[model samples]
Target: MKNLILSTAALALTAGIAMADTVRMGTEGAYPPYNFINDAGEIDGFEREVGDELCKRANLECEWVKNDWDSIIPNLVSGNYDTIIAGMSITDERDEVIDFTQNYFPPAASAYVGASADVDVTTGVVAAQTATIQAGHVAESGATLVEFATPEETIAAVRNGEADAVFADKDFLVPIVEESAGELVFVGDDVPLGGGIGLGIRESDGELRGKFDEAITSMKADGSLNELIIKWFGEGVPTYNADGSVVTN
Candidate 1:
């Protein structure tokens, strides 16, 4: 019987079936207000809070695993972690490789930050984190796209004049722009991208996906999720209705 059980496990592995005993949560611990390392060197951010609540509601024992943004998806597929709770937007292209839970974050805009407000974001050299939706948008927008491995590097590119502007999520840029103390300013019209941020799971983990989906749905129904959204992204951001529909102010 033990041998039969081992054979079944091997078959599951060969079939790319993923099952988790601890539900390891993967994140890019560099994007603030999504997931980032705190001063204590622990993952702390909006996604961290949300992931913990989701795991609790789903009755799952979960732990976070930090990973580089560029390799996050591949690592999840390789079984380095069970789910990606990073600030990953849901897109059809990514959906082909991994399943996503219903969006926890509302559809947000991407903005450009530059040394000056008059910087031409449409045709100028723009920096974006590699493999992000922002990078793809820049590539197709006639802008010279400079891709960086991390979000911090994208901003640094703008500061050092390697790029005219850095395009990134508005929520991630707000605090940065505010703290720039008149050094950095927003340029160009905000571009709406992606379907909103969701938890990424392997396509083979249907049951695990359902568990998170149900947990997210319950949070939406109870208004706790919206509270958390406002707490992190601030008010006036789009929120969720009881039915899981986005309610924009």
Candidate 2:
């Protein structure tokens, strides 16, 4: 029930306007720890909390808009939403289309999860959420890449034998692997991908992006950003220092 199918019309009209005073915060509500709909049916999770804090610091009235992952960027460009605070990574290809604020979360590794530790992830069919850097890596790593629209589907592909493994953010896979008990396990060495996670904004919205960047910088300076990172990703999660240097354990 994480993926809420919302009508574009409802999101574009009934939601807050894309004006100077109000900004629509777009997210893939299906991704947990990053974003997910709570039992109260509200967008609640790490990114939601972080986005709320960012808006408050920037002095903008923001409303949440849930969008499917596959069309997130396109919808942003079409004015369906003002900014994407989803757990999207900062990548050069993505930067070509939409501008990104300074990273709020430091770079993390992409890991493979499979039914067995010995699975040949490099040669076997590996699944990844479509449009992610992990999917691009799998396609080029001599693996048969199976793309899914959602992260849940990628894990399902491995569970149902459609794929030998699933590749995703290690932080995202940790809870799943733990919840699975013995069914799922990390299979191979973690692969570092993407620069870091950032908020996606329209290339024309330089002012808006600067506001968020400033807010993020403020959080880092006060150590609140690192606290939030540890709260969600656990202690020892990598973070950027106030001076914008990576802090890794």
What is candidate 1's CA lDDT for residue 185? 96
- What is residue 170's positional error in candidate 2, in angstroms? 0.6
Which regions of candidate 2 deviate over 4 angstroms? 1-19
**Local accuracy of candidate 1 as per-residue lDDT tens digits, 130-208:** 8787887888989999988888998899889899999898889999999999989999788888888889888788899
RMSD of each: 7.4, 4.9
lDDT by residue for model 2 over 138-189, one digit each (tens)?
Answer: 8899999998998999999999999999999898999999999899999979
Task: Name the 10 consecutive residues with the lowest summed lDDT in model 1.
Answer: 1-10
* Cα TM-score per model: 0.92, 0.92
Error of 2 at 98 (Å): 0.7
Model 1, residue pairs in steric clash: none
Q: What is the C-alpha lDDT of each candidate?
A: 0.83, 0.85
